[model samples]
Target chain A: MGLQQPSFSLTALAAVGLATAMLCAASTPAEAVPSFARQTGLACEACHTVFPELTPFGRRFKLNAFTLTTKQEISDINERKQGTLSLADLPPLALMFEASSTWQGKRVPDSNPSAPAGSQAQNGTVEFPQQLSLFYGGKIADHFGALFQVTYSQPSDHFTIDNSDIRYADQSQSGDFLYGLTLNNNPTVQDVWNSTPAWGLPSMTPPVGLAPAASPLIGKLGAQVAGAGVYGMYKDVFYLEGTVYHAALTGKTTPIDSTSGSHLDNYMPYWRAAYERQWGRHSAELGTYGTHAHFNQGGLNPENGLVMGADTFTDVAVDGQYQYIGENHIATAQASWTHENQTWQGLLNAGGTSNSKDNLNQYKVTGSYYYNRTYGGNVTYTRLSGSTDALLYPVGTSANGSPNSQWETFEVDYLPFLNTKVLLQYTLYQKFNGGSNAYDGVTNRKASDNNLVMLGLWTNF
Target chain B: MKKVFLAAVGLATVLAHAASAATESPPKLAREVCSKCHGPEGISQSPLFPRLAGQQAEYLDQQLHQFRDRSRGDPHAQAYMWGVAGPLTDAQIKSISEYYASRKPVHGAAPSDPALAAKGKEIFFNGLEARNVPACAGCHGEQAEGQGAIPRLAGQHADYLYRQLRDFRSELRENETMHANVQSMTDDDAAALTEYLASQ
Candidate 1:
């Protein structure tokens, strides 16, 4: 046997579907699902404005998406003789969904003996999906199409619609020159990376010095929607995008001035640019993203001896990826380094309230292999650290931001079925400083690790 | 010299034709084995059963592999498909996938109603922006011809579209990309987009 087909359990198909999406999925795109697009040998834009997002064509692909192998052929839209709309070329409203459930290895200590009594669970259990979504991908117009979708889960009732966007694209026969726009709503950087997505620093384990889940640094809710962005591709190689949006609700910001209750409320402007080049089986990209904001918060915390201050953080990253594409084998490795910084450390006293400014550095690497039906798997590792220690506010009052030495993670994906998969993973973290998660006395800080067992379903729709 | 070149070209054309004939769907696997449930030539008439004819080769390979590996969740179909899809090796999947994709789809008729088609087109081109509805043609294409991973939407089933849009708006579906787009859309947009897409 070349490789045992690895398939994970599919529990809580609703809740886990989203977790998998946050971890394994990359970038928010509007179009047919990635696996489906990959199967069709069609560029994502053929049906989507972005990856994992859908357009009209993307929606059609979903209707009858799963039964491709059984199909006879793709009818040419132009060849249809009698109908105003070519029935021969229409796609279906088929779809693919996945979910998984994970069991965490770490134990929850009994801080209060009288707390809600529960099982001292040791063996981890996970219920979520590798791909759980209800989608419609296909053509909606003579030329335009889309992927419309929504996902239902626990913790919230009303179904949340996402990954929906519209697109109009054009490409020459030679496959050069692609132009289009995507009208959509997506989370900001903070919201997009909320928690330690399997893709980001492990949310399972908090960094050294900082409290993991305990920190006020929870991921932001998605914002910055209701806008149109332009995307262009030259020679089917170089690519670019530009967009703008206003936040729905004014962000809750840190105090920026000593004056009680006086703050700056303004619409933040964000811009991101990236360049990618592929060589052989590898591709490399360099990118920079920036956002400028004038914050305004409530009155100063005079009781806590606090003053408001204006701040901004600009981030930049360098990334690279390589793919080993063979007739029967496929493998890929990708890595990136990101740096972030803010202004204002100088105004506040050393390790004082004004010292909230920070500079951080992060790095990640992941690899995946798909060897024809015999076997397939993927593994990824990431780390994040700080150039200068972050400051403490509400808690850990006198503590200084420690260098984030422990944002480490490891994950493994097993494809037991031909195209289906189950992934299991674990992560370790340490926050050696006195910020967020750390709150031991004045500098509440310590090292923490998390063992997560994830089992879920992954498939091509 | 020119006459000789023309003769050579003619010979090459004949040879190419021979090559085409030599490449055929695996003889053992025919419509008899697959069409019984999937419908003639792998296309389906039932709304629930997806049409399979005319899908791309890679797509077929990927799905077959997913099912065989058990990475996808479908216990309902597993009882029926497990044995058949499992025994096939990678090489077999590739060939079968190629053979099926190479076949063309049997044509069908367009919807008889023109009013729905016209209304759907309006939504496709110019969305209700005041209501924050975005146009569909902005990204997919003026003609709905997709590129790089996007699916083709020109022609599809109306019931399928309607079912999906409702699923999305109602949260029965949890899609990351389209979920947000649907969050603000009214039921009308979903209906309009569905009707338009199905008509396409």
Candidate 2:
């Protein structure tokens, strides 16, 4: 059967919207919650410079599968004196709340076409609880643990499974090497470093905002697939990991068929390698990671039985981080660059793209400084560029059939208590969707028109 | 007489069993859990964690007890130690303390600044008379090898020692003697003293 007409002919702008929504939803703020503190009997500083940004010790904590505990446990032993059951007296459960208000530089066009000839949506939006999440994190068994989250987003008004990483970890008898296996729902969700896409900078941003039309495939697949991998660290310096992913759609029938949304035709493979060095109060890491995937646009045509071919994407990235942790001052800097190559065989077969192959590159650099973990600020700059393909990035969103955008983000954070934070963030766009002005080709929209200011309160218990 | 003999035999067996249990579990716990941060032999790699090897058994025992009872109110103690010490038994604490104290002591790395080390050595041996600061060696040994209930300062990370001095001065650590000793000390004095002690 040939490719389905409706699925293949879906406007590039719609596809971009879907991708952007998924990326934004998936990048919700991750945390180092109080439950972990209760389990380990260690303070938040032991594992984090700030919430969500891990220290060397925190990285090790995750490498060990978050199984370290100082809490009392109910236990049992077998005839050979081997432990059979070990359950923490207190469950590792935590709840997080995020409330935010966002102001756009200019209001967007009202989406309701039946309204007046000229209309605009409200310029400011408030989410009483922008997002609420419940987490079950920490040791699940002797050498197994999990950090699982279920989130309720205000815009969606529903609870859905979020990022999750379950692991089985162990160390060598001589304690020279550490190794683990992970079953996670998202790429880089199991990674210890924030340089990776999943935990990268701009950690918190407004949920509803204008975003770039194109991103790497790896950045868009979070929570839509499942992966299993093995990872290891040698001498606490070198790290290596490999994972393979398959489609695992939520709220969808098992053994997916053509009716399922976009899904992998076969397992995607992801790999990572890194080297970290520590001396005194300074720590630095350099790493490279990549993924390759083949996806089938699932749908059936009235004439053509099914969409027949798969589109392939190969993504590779290099990242680095440097940190200086002092008694009263802490500083961190991170940078990353990603390259993606796309082959749209299935889409081209259905006349979806003007070009069969395209390429994209993204670069980001961020720096942050905090004093006593009480007050901090962060600055980040990001640039993304890709090949021009008319049918792939059509008019309405991309005037020049190109996906090029650049922006800078500035944020200031205040913490009155360890578990609570108040933050103000601003984003300024330089170029979006190929042009600074008339970017959408349908209206007099300027790249700067999408600028955003957001203020938020985040806390967990 | 026969009943008395039987009772004595039973008591001796019980004592032996308790001794064996005490000896066996502490090492396992030390290796499996404590070693994650404090290093396998109690010489920690991170300055965030203090080296435990060759510390005074009495000091270690006293501190663990304080942590368990929530009396040691330092930020790190509250964050990291309270939970760990919460579940520890008296015997476990005693065994763990002795286990760490018996290990080989750490040899401090060379001081980053020799001048600072020299100044610190002076402050260690002789009181900072102008500032009314007492000599550190008076209570800690002349070699900085501390006595009972006094922490050994030699070979500890300079960063760790400096923070501890700050904590003591602020009374966050809540030790009357330590607070009195460090209250008059300035930042420069703390830097110098920690440098010298770390180079020991």
Candidate 3:
């Protein structure tokens, strides 16, 4: 039983606010742009098992900074006969568009306070153009390349910088190893593995679907900061990378001020290490990555406007992937788990939370199978759990003030062309916001009420 | 005597430089570019790409020419090799072909099913009289070590071999001789042959 006769107006505002805030941190589907195919003169299959998942060759292509081009080039040489310039005759540019329709299991309560009893909002949503993106995704020089994207979402109605990575790479003279440097705005945007947060499974989701309230800071910060790092692969087996990040606030003043919400206090450090092995038609990879960050909570003292104390977050994760690519069938399984340690000293001092220390954990596993790169299906199971804080996760949204949720997603996809994909995805939630029934405490809403089914068409050219 | 010694040293230096320059590009290209997919020395680990090591030089040359000229209209040829071969000069192709052909060929892995291998061996060495199929070894050699412009089938990836046979039969590969030889071969027969060839 739940409090069904609560203040409808207040509950409606709180629900909308929570949903809107959560949407900003939800996963944005990763993409495999066609510019790389055009630049290298290779078909999409040469680099990907499907559009966004990498093959061994695709991983190597990214490791080389996407500069392996066979296209005609305009060239120049210096006086010493050292090459000074080499530019592709055709610019590496591409466009991607996605449209989708989403249906939720149950309609939400109407926001209008004067509405008749049992009135509900619409249960179905159609987004004509869920997202449209332009990409510059290939070589710029002999050893430098970039995958830069600008995207427009129907919800936002404005174009903004999306996931972008620019890199410079070269191989050792002995051809035994490769090393590169990357500058990117996202923590795992430069990663080559799908097991990483930036490219993980459930490649796409409805823009407005309900999501867990808490996630690791490492997975949440994308396009909000800039990072530079160096990575290397030895004998095509071992991989290692390290990077440091600083705030690159968007739509903000030149110099960050109090207006900017909680931001990186100074810099955050991120690192990754992985090992891969390939034999015959099989490949496997195991990896670990983590980040440590200190944040300025933006709480200022009233007297002098001096900044208050800071909060800290440390997140570490382990991931692995196994791929079997037969002549006609391709199968892949990947799993990742992340543990976060949070110390909200600043927020605690400001009375924003009931506890100064808490922890959260997320686990995900996905398995997929495809036949001849044409039709495929995947299943993903995700679980999230964290220590409860009454003030942090209040009663209306989280019945028990606990951040615990679990869900499973199943998706089937058909690709008529390598660049075009049609997908149907369904998500079932076993628990949300700490409970299955009356999860939100005030609305008599069940976790299953948020079950989502989405049909989408995505293509890039 | 001093003048003669100086002349001899200068001639030796010139010859050495010319020899190095003449042989450099192919190995560099092979190591840096082709090796990404084909693996070093063309012993590719993935069945999606074919092994080029120990292939007949003349065959490699002909294929490269076909790829560059868009005459090899197979799906894979159009998708992968056309753009790669387009920019190569004839000399570069010849040198690259020779470089791979000189490398040691791959050794076949043991077949998973010995019975399948045995059937394939029989077909490779003897004709299917009822089906009017010719013995593959008549042209591929007793050991499947092809000669001149014929391709070596021994130790090739089984999947690659099977697909090529299918393409030839379907005329997708546009090889009159190969199509004539494989047109009547059934999928089972092709599978057996690939198994046997892959096991050498």
lDDT of 3 by residue, A195-311 (tens): 888888888777666676667788767777998777778778998887778888777665766666567777788889999999878999999999988877652444423267777
lDDT of each: 0.42, 0.81, 0.82
List the candidates' TM-scores in order.
Answer: 0.47, 0.91, 0.90
Worst 10 residues of 3 chain A by lDDT: A1-10
Question: Residue A423's C-alpha lDDT in candidate 1?
Answer: 49
Local error of candidate 3 at A385, Å? 1.2
| lDDT for each residue of candidate 3 in B38-157, tens digit (9 for 90 to 100) | 886788888888999999999999999999999998888988898788888899899889988998898798999889999999999996777767899999999898998899999999
Q: Give stretches of model 2 more than 4 Å off.
A: A1-29, A113-117, A300-307, B1-26
Off by over 4 Å in 3: A1-13, A25-27, A109-121, A299-306, B1-26
DockQ metric for all predictions:
0.01, 0.19, 0.20
For candidate 2, what is the DockQ?
0.19
Highest-DockQ candidate: 3
Residue lDDT tens for model 1, A1-461: 00000002111121121122223222122123543333333433333222222222332333221222222234334455522342213354545445556554344332233444442323443333323457655444433445556654332333456555555443322223344545444422211111121123221221111122111111121332333444454432454444444333323343333333322234333343455554322334454444444333323344433334444445555555444443346565556666656454222322233345656566667665556523555555655565443332222221343444444445455555433445455544444333335422232223452334555554545
Task: Please give the distance, in angstroms, between residue A61's alpha carbon in candidate 1 and its true position after superposition.
Answer: 12
Task: Assess candidate 1 and give its lDDT.
Answer: 0.42
Q: Whose TM-score is greatest here?
A: 2
